[model samples]
Target chain A: MDRGGRMTAVVPTRATAPASGVRAAARIVAAPDGRGGTALPVLDGAGPLALRRTRAVAPGTAQVTVVGAMSAPLGGDHLSLDTRVRTGARLAVGSAAATVSLPGRCGRSATYDVRLTVDSDAELCWLPEPLIAAAGSDLAMTTRVDLAEGARLVLREELVLGRAGERPGRLVSRLTVRLDGRALLDQGLALGPGAPGWSGPAVLDRYRAVGQLLVVEPRFRDRPCQVAVLPSDPAEGEAMLTPLAGPAALVTALAEDALMVRRLLDAGRQAAAAAAG
Target chain B: MTITTTAPANRAALLVLADGRFPAGGHAHSGGAEAAVAAGRLYDATSLEAFCRGRLDTAGLVAAALAAAAAAGVDPLLLDEAADARTPSPALRATARKLGRQMMRAARACWPSPVLDALAAARPRGAHQPVVLGVTASAAGLGPLDAAHAAAYEAVSGPATAAVRLLSLDPFDATAVLARLAPDLDRVAQQAVDSARLALDSDVDALPAASAPLLEIAAERHAAWPVRLFAS
Candidate 1:
């Protein structure tokens, strides 16, 4: 397939040569139709990526799979993804899960970038599981999303600082969100800065882990809804961290300080749950 | 009402950030109230304050970062990108944009400055709450520390108010959370003031990479639910 064409495919097969890594490319071409829909293209390291129907699984279905791999293994290697969902079409993309190996002296890391384009009336949900970076490994990733007029897109990416057990020292991550040529969200984080206030009331308050989820659906526009957990009209589609129940209650009881709520967990789960609840 | 020429802009900035009525999409998020309720963690003001403080600390870092970035005259967009990087969960990012859009609306309504227009031009995008607050502070003639204070306060308030419902917190108890947080809020404001002087390296030392892991797990689990109340 032509590299410059709107719809193209590139896949490296084992027979082609004896390489350790695999490379694949797929594209979507939407005509002038007023309606939008997504074309699922099942990708393989050997053959051309083909379109398939969106798949669904049963409840309590928690399974993990690794779709592709590198042709050869080296001291440091990575995986990459480049995608663009056509306008008016809806797409939900996710990976089975990620398996990460620690980096040696080379200190090499794996990376992934996903570029999404949503046109008018189209919707996309890219909620992938957290990719754990083993100890001593450095990882960097970026997700660039472009939404056209009246388009809706939701892209979710989670990064585990280190495997729950492997326990990586530090994980650096970045994310950028844009719509209609305007940048809506840009965030960068480095979890291991051992400073004076590092784990104090002034900073993260010692939360060892971190995670966030972003959802952008135009359908919810002008609609007033509350999170299931916290059924309050969030003045804005936003909420931050509050103290944990244990610490907050204890502090207030002991110190007579109402702000005691400012002493507990970071904004990740506690805040989201409390606020959403 | 008495008026002071000393710094009328500071009061305005505070008002802009303080008013929960700002058009920013923040109204859409219950902070983690939804997640906490789902997790059975936040059931009352006792739990609500704890939840609010955690969010304040984690998100405060980002707000402080934005305040510092704005004080340094760095591009608000860059600060926004930095904020984005810090937030790993997609649900939170959506919440930010929703709030941002509202801030843009409020800014356009209350303060018709060029920066507000530029941000409005950016629309449903670009106009994140912190970025807009910083720029609006600049436009309204407030200092970085003051702007940071407003941003931090708003960050705290959004969740605190939501907790009232989740935990069935009494209005008096909820307001007490704010009053109690006074000293720390002042201290955080000072830190935000100091952070404004830091150089804009990708490191963003002003903030930390700490977030609630369980919250993320809940958000993911919440999104898949067929019927849910919160946007996060």
Candidate 2:
């Protein structure tokens, strides 16, 4: 599953998940082949996870889907993913469905980590489905992205604390993005009843769901990006938007439900598109 | 924790740095209290105490760690990047830099150190506020633990002072809230200094990254408020 100019030894042994849940890992590396085709130098998956590439929707762009067991991961489960877009290549990654995380036995938490890299002049758009943390669940996730000069990236993340009428679980999420070896955005949050900031008005404001969108590129930095506020009831939600250093912008929203959070993300996406153009 | 240093530590410098009237541009900002008041989540002394305690442990702890690292003579540029990574809200980042610039202006006039001048010349726009605080403390002959105390105190004091104005709550109550949290603040400062000592040996990334999402989100929302009393 490992390929390219440099040949690295691949560990063929796979770790199996327990009957309660699954521990999975995957890595995808895309490069431009001299033969005019997109070269997948690395495509590997373990446990119940699978990686699939769909037909390209545009020139130089390839779509990737994450296929996995539909059941929620059990407590103490770990999911890891790594992706790389080589020079001159474009990649769009999406998930087949939402990930539901269940509580681990004996108070153990599940974790997910994703590491992404984009070479110079490469583009990446990762729009994954919302993550639902079931009641009594404890989950932690971290995503780190490294971008070379001239790289373009659009990333979105959505989180729902729990299903309707259920109390939310604990969640700790972190995102670190860098451009040309300089930090662009570094953000981390701990939510749910156990976190100290969970009840603060400035954190979740008692909202059940939250979403964030980050757009980074040289073209979007100087341009003003405005986030549209949906005229919802005061008790429903609120949205915030700001431009960061190094041609980046972030839009965050908190809402009473998942659909409203999605709507907020759409507004941000539109604004990002407008800024990029 | 053993701190290997050549210079004697100035204990009195902590009081000067932690003073509310430090002219560091902190008076204009409420530490997200303005937005909380607008949202009706804060009203009386009870909720204010809760809010201050939360800020003390999360954002306050992180800031103290960063400041301690800076005072410990760790690279300022690296600490600045770590600050940027720990802070997620763009508006909050801008505010930190703005405050950092103001602090630099005051620190240069008070301490008059070559390091301060070099940092100002390099980051003309300003570095993160905690980073500047740490460097300023170092230049003042203060130890990393002293810087942590100042940072941890400021974290709760800023919000407590703001609540008095934003809610028209009794000034005595706000002051009392901070007084009650003195022991917890000491613990947080100690923890921050410990973490900073570890960071000096390993990576700056080892510093605490505790965050308040609503504080960041509210700062962004507050930035767009056309008629707000506070700057952030």
Candidate 3:
């Protein structure tokens, strides 16, 4: 199929050939259409990146769901997702399924870079499915968000070390969130192989699933969010909500499974939104 | 640190600055050991060593890098912001600043440098402890490596000492944990200096941002505890 001048196969095969891996960039741009709804001006997807406009529940929010057309981000593949939420607009980007990284013949690591931008008076909800790092696969994922003044953001990041009954490959994830030219949160977490002491008492401590929720609300400029320990659901492990130095608050949680982590983080998002209002 | 302040960097200065009894307000904090103990994650010497090892590599690496950057002559204000960007827990951030303020007082009195005084003036509430430690190291005529070593050592030593008190484990076992971690501390300090050198040439964003989420969550939980032996 011809996707924006690039010849990409509509349905990718499962041959797992390292040489045939495609490097692609997906783009999504959302803006208000002046009719009390949001518009998607640029929704281009190629290769394994399949971007589809989903039904957004909010009044003026546009939702885009990423559907992987192929079993990728295998080793040696380079993928990028670039998104922009224009002024007075809202965007929620999610994924259809969990992305599982696999080892390819190339024996090199894969890279996934996601860049999100929100303009003044705009909002972005970036909640994607968990990323599972399979055994023998190495991937480096980076997500950077740039928020203009008066912009609000709700971002969720979750990582599962490996599938059940298997060891995990090395996965390094870097998250940098900036608001109005100032940094809100910047953290690099390395798990599985190559990261010594990650599963020790002070770190994961036998927990395999980890996630966090970051809420950047301009309302926090006046009265800051109070730091509190999030009450854990009986199934979950531990979580906390702490106000950032900037106009943001973060909820960090660790659990035995991805479902529990997401539950804790979703509860955190509600608390943040309710507090902001 | 020495008889004269004009002399070359005194080795004892690092000893004094990094001393557990330096009155830097670190004694009240457990570096997450208290929470780990309360959670039963750390109840013995072996588990305590493992916990300290994790802290040394994640939080320890970041702290050492920030301190090294400061001691390398990077702007303290800029480093302070970088520290904030790396620290996600409000309780942890507050503890760092409070410790920074106390360290500032001690550093200004001991080293008496204009840089220390200026940083203290800029951050009245106080800067991050690592950044202040870097500046204090520079004031004492030490270098970035020295600052990194001090910070890295403190990362393990604080938890070890606290584990001794909290777990009531043998004191010698605690010191042995630190001794076994000496080689790891050296390696982390070296890596921190390299990162600091890179940041000095480029920007503070180049510093390490390694994070341990359990530590952050535990710290916040400990902060909210109705009654606790440790402040954080």
Q: For each candidate in the order shown, give its overall lDDT on alpha carbons.
A: 0.49, 0.79, 0.86
Name the regions of candidate 2 deviating beyond 4 angstroms: A1-23, A33-37, A55-59, A70-72, A221-234, B1-9, B85-90
Q: Which docking band does candidate 3 fall into?
A: medium
**Best-to-worst lDDT order:** 3, 2, 1
lDDT of 2 by residue, B209-232 (tens): 876766776676677788998887
Q: Which candidate achieves the best DockQ against the true structure? A: 3
How far residue A238's Cα lies from its native spot in candidate 2, in Å, is 1.8
Give the higher-DockQ candidate: 2 or 3.
3
Interface root-mean-square deviation, each candidate: 12.0, 2.5, 1.0
Better candidate number, 2 or 3, judged by TM-score: 3
Candidate with maximal lDDT: 3
Name the weakest run of 10 consecutive residues (lDDT summed) in model 2 chain B: B1-10
Q: What is the lDDT of residue B46 in candidate 3?
A: 94
Q: For model 1, what fraction of the real interface contacts is kept?
A: 0.07
Better of 1 and 2 by DockQ: 2
- TM-score of the B chain in model 2? 0.95
* Poorly placed runs, candidate 1 (over 4 Å): A1-277, B1-9, B123-126, B200-210, B223-230
Give per-residue CA lDDT, model 1, range B93-168, as digits (tens): 5667667777777766776787677666755464456777777776776667767777778766766777676666
Best of the two (1, 3) by DockQ: 3
**Best-performing candidate as measured by TM-score:** 3
Total clashes for model 2 = 6
